[model samples]
Target: YTYNNRINRISIIQEHVMLRRAIERGVSTERLATALAINIAQVEKRLNLLDGICAETADLLKDRQCSADVFAVLRRMKPTRQIECAELMVSANNVTMAYARALMSASTPDRLVNAKRAPKPKGLSDEQLGLMQKEMSGLQDQYRMAEQTYGEDTLNRLLFVQEAKLLSAQALTVIAQVRFAKRQTSVDFGPSAGMR
Candidate 1:
């Protein structure tokens, strides 16, 4: 006979509560693991699900359908950001592990539990990101100077749409600046035209 793990497995929050009750009843880790037919580390993980969690965020998520890994991501955030993310999840009606991880990825260092250990931009350090910002601004300044030298008629209108990477609000500012610099825009403004 084949067994289905889904039928035997409980929800992540339920397992957390069950493990808490077991611990209160003087159950040892090994004994609990044996009784539950799971690894001791699994039992330990459930027991510590709320270790760094705040009351508001826990209450917000206690009844939500989220995986144990979501809590792991929440543990990396500060309480305020945890609350904010929880509220956002509730508002968006999505409490998936992927969404939680996305929120974690978008969080700034100030909103993290450990700023010193905050994840850097992929393949770039803080200093590199700073330098890149300076370089981008310089390019924008050059574009403005060229427009001034040749007039808007000589230059083609440009539009920018975000697709490649998640960027700061500054990217939108750049797009707005480019749009403002143009006076007349054509119906099909060449290869670099953005959507209306």
Candidate 2:
């Protein structure tokens, strides 16, 4: 039965939990195996699995006694990510704003250092300057939205990890069901009718 497989997985997870508890309690493997109703070999398999896990994660999987510490460590290890596309767009937008500001500031021909007395190329027309300001504001809004979306994606990744753990737990249930089914006797309907 598939239950058998689930049973196996549950047993393994249980063994792992036991081994971790043993480590925390300073209990001997022999005692832990006895307590868990599993042989020493199985206990060792669980220990090996624990040995490979990182300290912070192992702590989380085990007793969860210091959740604050675990969270702090995770924060430190979190990646330093940047939104490249958004950054590029922001840079381009900044350049455009600067250009517009320069045009707006340019002195008229009457005031130009070189114009001495001629008119300037007509300092940025009011309409064009207003349009430039609007475009700059729009880009800034887009940049803000981009950052928000990136943060949301990071949250999604954390959720996915949690979901994976849930699925793994479900797998154990399925395996147990398989194991149980396999132990059942089925009647043969063809060729050997009523041979039970």
Candidate 3:
């Protein structure tokens, strides 16, 4: 006899919680792998997904639709940097592993959680890294400014367009009234040819 089982898709947050609970309940990785019908490595990866993540960063990303790999990349950054990167990703509507890795690459050594284990640059020199850090700082400032002004700018544009439309309608109405009045005056006074 064969038994068919239906498995529901789980969110990243839910998976993390389940893995943590399983560990707390003295469940082994092998048991989790068997239960989930996944490989032992996959079970271990999910179990350690939030191992190095700070509470604040975890809370910030709890409701996000990002994958476990994205959180793994974020674990390389310090708490403050993690929060900043998470906020940036959320604001940009991007929560991909690539974006997280890019943020990690742009992070300075001091901003990383494990500065000693920082990835060595293959082709780029220290000077290039410094320049990149400065550029990233400038970009972050610009992003914040844009975020702050977005709503106000949108409202201003909407008001301007509405006012222009209102003015255009009023102008058209006035022009039509003027044309009607002129036609009436011309009729009352008789044709110019008749006057001549």
Q: TM-score of every model? A: 0.56, 0.25, 0.83
- What lDDT tens digits, residue by residue, belong to model 1 across residues 41-109? 988988999988998998898777688888888989999989978877886688988888767766666
User: What is the full ranking by TM-score, best candidate first?
Assistant: 3, 1, 2
Q: lDDT: which candidate is best?
A: 3
Q: What lDDT does candidate 1 reach at residue 119?
A: 61
Where is model 1 more than 4 Å wrong at Cα?
1-10, 123-196
Give stretches of model 3 more than 4 Å off.
Answer: 1-8, 188-196
Arrange candidates by lDDT, descending: 3, 1, 2
Question: Candidate 1: what lDDT?
Answer: 0.76
Runs of candidate 2 with Cα error greater than 4 angstroms are: 1-129, 168-172, 175-183, 187-196
| Number of backbone-clashing residue pairs for each candidate, in the order shown | 0, 22, 0
Worst 10 residues of 3 by lDDT: 1-10
State in Å the error of residue 116, model 3. 3.6
Instruction: Please state the error at residue 23 of candidate 1 in Å.
Output: 1.1
**Per-residue accuracy of model 2 over 56-138 as CA lDDT, tens digit each:** 44333332222222222222221211122213323444323333223323322222223333222356576774566467557
User: lDDT for every model?
Assistant: 0.76, 0.49, 0.86
Indicate whether candidate 2 or candidate 3 has the larger lDDT.
3
